[model samples]
Target: MELSSLKFYNVIVLGFAFMLMFTGFQTCGMVEQTVLKSYRNDSIVNGTVTYNGDGYTSLAIIYVVFAFANWLAPSVVSVLGNKFSMVAGGITYTLYLSSFIKPITATLYIGSVLIGFGAADKQRIPLYIGLTSVCALGTALLLILRSHPIQKLEVGDPEEDQPSEEEEETSDEAAMLNDSLDVTHRLSWKLFLTRDMMILSITFFYTGLELTFFSGVYSTCVGATERFGEDSDKLVGLTGIMIGVGEILGGALFGIFGKKTIRYGRDPIVLMGGAIHMVTFLLIFLNIPDLAPLNKTPDSAYITPNTYLAVACGFLLGFADACFNTQCYSIIGTSYPDNSAPAFALFKFEQSLAAAIGFAYSSHLVLKWQLLILVIFAVAGVVAFFVVERKVRSRAEPSGSSYRNI
Candidate 1:
């Protein structure tokens, strides 16, 4: 009955609901490139090409549209309010999943666009129907969630000053309008020109770039390597599962030790994540054939493709990715608590744009070149993050206190 307890319960329920939905959604994303690519290759071989699309193209479209959707999400959320906005968003997923049943290229592309909307945030029974059913359940749960509690001032409390109901309603409406205007202003050129935003954008962009790789491209490379044997297709799913495991582990650790980690600040965690990613990239370069990114390849890299290595890399990639994301969320929230909507919108915009570009080139670039690009961005991103963090800390320091290096 207590507000805090009710809030915690809501969060827990929401977490579980999302877990169920994303379990299906993320699994599909992980395997989509491989599955679609295989279908295309097979069709070509058989001369029966009904669908001419590949997963890379589909993912590229999703992220590019997702980038644009970020600009519209705030207005959509403001108009619909948070809860209904989520339900509306959830329905998009169901529609996306439904498109998979017959798998027409047009439908798939349309579904990709719809899902991109959902994701900036669908299904089929056929095997996809099961995924759709799971997601629908999650949406159902969202529909039932209690809206967040509104706190009322108690008489005799220091902040107990209260206004008449009509006055309060007018004030609240004014505040809402002002907040919306503030978000819009911040999302404009002013925020983009800030030194902090510019620097942080690099890290944000890299996160998206790296995100596309592990979530989509890496699995495709794994599936395409013939050296891994006919079971390479199976390995794609397994690699995805391992990545999910690592992500869960990292999330659990960060959630548990979050307060403690704050003592040392976010940069250390980000640096550690970047280091892990660099190592993972090195291993991929050594372990996967260069041609793996373009198509199914009959060759091996310097090291023969070992199932264990692929799985381990996936785990490391996922774990490191969690580190970057969690830290980025913290940094943005702390830096722009007053204007978090625009800040987050900018973050998603940059991230999605980078992801779109990465996926666009996924089919064209070799594994080595992709790895090199990741490394270059990783280094630049880390440096930029450090610079912005220092500036933020400097600003946060008390007027008379010595600035302690993080």
Candidate 2:
């Protein structure tokens, strides 16, 4: 007997993703830094650039697009064919990968529109909030649904025969009632009510905020500090080095300790990852200099051990990001089999919405409070940790059907 079609598809989807995601993910680290550095001189507040309704017209636009993406992801999947959706998303990402956004008025606006429009083609995001968000959203949408050509079919035994429409209706209705899902209501909306997914979703909001700060404030630290120099782009590029190193370490750790992590499943891993995330963030926040000149000075002495520590912490942060994501996905897949696609979709939504809000919030906070914003953001990370354990972990379970079941 041959391998099942479902198994084949799974291999193709995940295998291709595992292979290509690196190129996409590694590219993103640098792109994010560049975008953040673009606003170096234009930072309205501290090192942040909160997009108010007017001041951040471009960020504002992108925020709306992301929100729209959240709303559309679940609802719009069937409307676009998988191939078309993939093509659209590819085109859109290519634009971002090539052009991205800048501090300037013109390019940023164009980039936002392109990114938003391209991102809207498909739905559902992935385990993490970064590259996963980019590819997962579209991949989930396509993966969730299936339709085989008539020729692929073979006759089945009587016991395995298809159920009658009445039986299906009754089953669907009963399932809906049992899950408290209203059959008449929008399917996607109800899908959002998964408690465990919500926990991750809430944390994503914090993730977005953290990333916004990371991109902008990280550059800020390097920029105003005497060490990195005026070329913020080059300083920001250091993120790639740290992320690359961390990814290599993460792979090695996964290779050595894979079974141990899986034996406990993702909860402990998520918890540990969350702790690492919170601590690294705290370390980064604590290190930010309170008083610094806006312009460069001859003494430029910020590149002390603190900068090296920050770099090391950055590597840990990236590792934490990867670990939490991988574990979370494994958990969702095992726990909520039926709702896995929806789970991931909601995950992306939270990340996107959070980033949109976080960018604006951090911008404002950094301007008014400086290090205080990063400090509180670190607190938010802690809160995010508890929220997952208390609110999400308890509820994650063997509910929802796999796409095949549906």
- Predicted model with the maximum TM-score: 1
lDDT of 1 by residue, 1-406 (tens): 6778778888987887787777767766776766665555545655676678667777888899989887777667766777888878777777666665556788778878987720100212255677778888887788766765456666678965456865878568756876876657566557778889998999999999998999898998898899998688778888888898888888776656666665767788889999999899999988999998777889989988899999999999999998888888878887887767778888989999999999999889999989989999999999998998777777778555433322
lDDT of all predictions: 0.80, 0.49
* Candidate 1 off by > 4 Å: 42-48, 117-126, 148-183, 397-406
What is the alpha-carbon lDDT of model 1 when measured against the actual structure?
Answer: 0.80
Model 2 bad stretches (over 4 Å): 1-64, 73-80, 97-104, 117-188, 191-200, 214-220, 229-233, 247-259, 290-306, 367-406
* Cα lDDT, model 2, residue 107: 54
Each model's RMSD to truth, in Å?
Answer: 4.8, 9.7
